[model samples]
Target: MIKSVLFDLDGTLLPLNQDDFAREYLTHIGAKVAQVIDPKKFVSQLLASTDVMVRNKDKTKTNQQVFLEDFLHKIGVAREILLPVIDEFYETDFVLVKSITRRAAAARQAIMAVIECGLDVVVATNPIFPASAVRQRLAWAGVDDINFKLITSYEQSHFCKPHVEYYLEIAAHLGRLPAECLMVGNDVKEDLAAARIGMTTYLVTDCLLNVKNAVINTDYQGTLQELAQTIAQIIKER
Candidate 1:
């Protein structure tokens, strides 16, 4: 019995080319903070810090904490100096990247179908970004109106995707066993990592991302429309 549904954002619910989105995102955010630090240097250090966050396994610090500590240290700036600027950028300039993302009608359908079944819905996007950025992306995906049981963000999550620990952390947050959760994502490796923890996996083929061309082994695979139909069938069986 699946008690919760976890959906990956970028390539899953939200259709986007990762590289293109990152380029547009960095361009906007870099411009926003150019006054405090050279945009070139800022982008470089920001990425390095993000890489540190991705590899971080420190349970003692949230991903945000790890990112900020390293980013601030490397840039030699106080949090008070850089944080507000970034926050303002997220509030104002972040929407500029939305043009690159198309709203997936099926994405909304799948999430609503899960909610209708009374299953907890979680936006299980990689926790490398701050909540503001994640929330904005969700808004662009057109699924931000409904409440999510948990929205994984750097402020809360300690691990990144493709790491089994990340799935475990989400399970812990939901107070549910991995066996009772269904992970839906487009990444062959990152999203399917949930299967390693005994969670059922659904691979969304639309906007699929298999960078390394790894063998894809998922319990269910199809478009978002098919996923919604699959859930409907499960509900009928129940």
Candidate 2:
């Protein structure tokens, strides 16, 4: 009864080394904003803001607001000053980092298969970055500008990955039960957390991350094409 398919962006839908991706992202953005503030300081402050967003428990404030408040405070600037820089950086500079990332055709095929089955598709990437940044990354994946049912950016999300509450929130937002959703991701801890709350899970192993060395117990696991086949099989059975 999987009515929705949630996909992770970084290593799942887009092939990339997470560490390398982060470094490239920061370097490009820092270089772009260096004229206004110290590049090193800007990077540090942005990271601190991400940490604050991760630890955020307040449901009232979106992760975006929490990040902005902390980021703007640490950098000693108004949102008016910092916001434009970030927006422009994502628009112009973020594209340069795509050189380190490669296309994931399996992911594109899988997404198309899911949509063809008449199931909802959601981009459940970790909400550490803003919508503009997320959109740009999706563009790099070759599926940019396609309308997904939802895209979890820091501006709209309240919780980060590895938290069951985040999955629950997505389920709620989609008006579906966890049992009716399938969570697809490359991270064992973060993506598989959906299973804890009753959703089915798929682990995409092409660029998998298992930092905790935790045992994986998802319903299915494999490359993105295999994942698509699994979903198709499930839908065919239904």
Candidate 3:
């Protein structure tokens, strides 16, 4: 009885190499902020700070807080100085990164199929970026802001994926049990983790990442075209 479907953005929907996307994202932000600060020193420090934050063990702090605290510590400048610059990056530079991503028609078709089936659709992209940045990425995926019932961004999310709590939080927000939700994603760890709490899982293999060597034992695994058919089958079975 899956009542909702959650989709990951970067690889699952937007079809891209995660490393290439990250490099482009960092380069764009770094270049834009160079006018305000020393480019070499700022990017180097920012990358170092990001590494530290990624390894942070605190569950209480949002990813944004962790990253910003680390960033401010390295820059030693008023946070206000960087706020507008970051905002500008999201508004302008972030959109330019779309050039690196190829639109997946099957992804869009799958999303529409889920919506047509009366299932809620959630953009469950990792909550590492702000809402504006997430929105920009969604646009790259051909998903309008109105497509998803909920879009997970750092501001609204308290936990990152691979943590069952993050999935639980989304279930709570949607007022649905995990058992009634299906998480469709490319990452074995981050997306499939929702299954721990009872959500049905679908691994979109087109952009799959199996870094942890986790054995993918899920029953549902396929390409975007297969997913569209799977959803149709589910509807027919109902």
What's each prediction's TM-score? 0.95, 0.94, 0.90
lDDT winner: 1
Cα lDDT tens digits, model 3, 1-238, are: 7888888898998899888887888888889988788777878877787666555557688777888888887796677887788788888788878878888888888899998888899999888789988888777778774568899987767777878888898999899999888888999988999989998888999988999898896648999778877876764443
Off by over 4 Å in 1: 234-238
Clashes of each: 0, 0, 0
Kindly report the root-mean-square deviation of model 2 from the true structure over all alpha carbons.
1.5
lDDT for every model? 0.90, 0.87, 0.82
lDDT of 1 at 66: 93
Residue runs of model 3 more than 4 Å from their true location after superposition: 48-61, 235-238
Q: 2 or 3: which has the higher lDDT?
A: 2
Candidates 1 and 3: which is better by TM-score?
1
Candidate 1 achieves a global lDDT of 0.90
What is the lDDT, from 0 to 100, of the residue 133 in candidate 3? Answer: 84
Kindly list the per-residue Cα lDDT of model 2 for residues 19-61, writing each as its tens digit. Answer: 9998998889988887788899988988888888888888898
- Displacement of residue 50 (Cα, Å) in model 3 is 4.2
How well does model 2 score by local distance difference test? 0.87
